[model samples]
Target: SDLPLLCQHFINNYNQENGTTVKGISNETLQLLTTYHWPGNVRELNIAIERACIDARKGIITVDNLLRFTQNVSRQNISSENYRGFDIKEARKEAEKAVIIRALKASNNNRRKAAELMEISRSALYNKIIELEID
Candidate 1:
C-alpha cells in the first residue's frame, strides 16, 4: 500500500536531486520491493533504491537493478528453479548462511570475532558453520 508510494517518493527525490529522468519502477519490480522483508528497514530500502536508480541510468528501474542492491543475499530471478517452491526453512537457512558469510568476511575470517558480531557463542557459530557447510 504505502510502501509503493514511499518507494515512488524516494525515486522522485533521487531523480530530482541527481537531475536524472528515471520515470518510475516497473510493476513487477515494485511488487518485489514492497513484498521484501527489508531486514535493514527504511535506511536499507533507501540505499537500495538509490543504488538501483544509479544503475538504471535514467530508465525505469527493473528487477535487475534491485537484484544488485545486496551482495550477501540472493535476489535473483524468481522464475528460476532455485527460488521456486521455496519454504520457510529453506529461506531461513539461506538468510543464516548469508549473515554468517557477511560476518565472517567483515571479521576477516576470524571465527571468534564473527561469532561476537553475531552475538552467538564461538562454539554455536562453529556448529552453524558446520551445519551450513560453509567453507
Candidate 2:
C-alpha cells in the first residue's frame, strides 16, 4: 500500500522542517491508517500524517496521535462504509473511550469534574476508566 510510503515521506518532511527526529509510525498506527477508508484519499492521508507528526512524541507516531488527527479532521467525513467490517461493540467501546479521554482532558484529569461534564456519576466514570483501561 502507498500509505506507509506516504506516511514515511510526510514524517521525513516534518523532521527536516522542524529538526525533530521522529523516527517512524508505530505498527498499530499504521494498521489503523490502512483500515481507514480515506474518503478524501491521498490529500487527507497527507494531512493526517502531518497532524500526527506534529503531535508525535517519544520518536514515533502512535495510535493516540492518529486518533487525535482523525477526531479533529475526519469526524464530519465518517461514513457507514467505514464500519463495513468493524464490530459494533468494538466501535462503541472506542467511541466511549475517546469521549472519556476528551472529558478527562477538558477537566484536567479531575474525575469529579469530568463526570459532571459527562453528566455521569463519579463512580460510574471510575468504572468506565477501569473498564476502558485508560491511563
Candidate 3:
C-alpha cells in the first residue's frame, strides 16, 4: 500500500537529518502500521515515523518499535514499574528522568529548548542530565 511508501518517506528524511543508516521498516512493522486507523492522519503518521526512527535499533525499525505508536505514546514513556517503589527519592528520580526525556523528545533534542520547556535553567538541565545519566 501507499502507507509503506509514506513511511519510507519519513524514514528517509529522518535518516538524512540524523545521519542514521536505518535501512527501512521491517515487513512485520509495515504490516502493523498499515492495520492502524491512524485517526490523526498524516501528522500522526509523521510522529510515529519519527518516534520509530528514534527507537529503531541495529538499522531497522521493528514491530516492537512501532508498538508505541498504537498506544498513548506519552503514557508509555514512564512505565508503571518506575513508581512501584516506596522510596520517594527513587520515585522522584524516575519522574524527573521521564520528564526530561519527554522534554528532550518534544524539543527534538535541543537542550536549550528542552530546559525552557521544563522551566529550568540550562545549567540546571545539564546538571540534572548528568545526575540522572540521561543520554
Backbone atom clashes (below 3 Å) for every candidate: 0, 0, 0
Positional deviation of 55 in candidate 2, in angstroms? 2.0
Which of the predicted structures, 1 or 2, would earn the higher lDDT when compared with the native? 2
Better of 1 and 2 by TM-score: 2
Candidate 1 stretches with Cα past 4 Å from truth are: 72-135
TM-score per candidate, chains pooled: 0.54, 0.64, 0.51
- Model 2 Cα lDDT, one tens digit per residue, 7-94: 9998998889989999999986777677667778988888888888887889899766765556533233222212334564665466
Q: Write the per-residue lDDT of candidate 1 for residues 10-97, one digit (tens) a residue.
A: 8999989999988888786776666567788888878878888987845888765665454322333231112334564565466567
TM-score of 3: 0.51
Ranking by lDDT: 2, 3, 1
Clashes of 2: 0
lDDT of 2: 0.74
Note the Cα lDDT for every prediction shown.
Answer: 0.71, 0.74, 0.72
RMSD of each: 6.7, 7.2, 9.1
Ranking by TM-score: 2, 1, 3
Better of 2 and 3 by lDDT: 2
| Model 3 / residue 50 / CA error / Å | 0.8
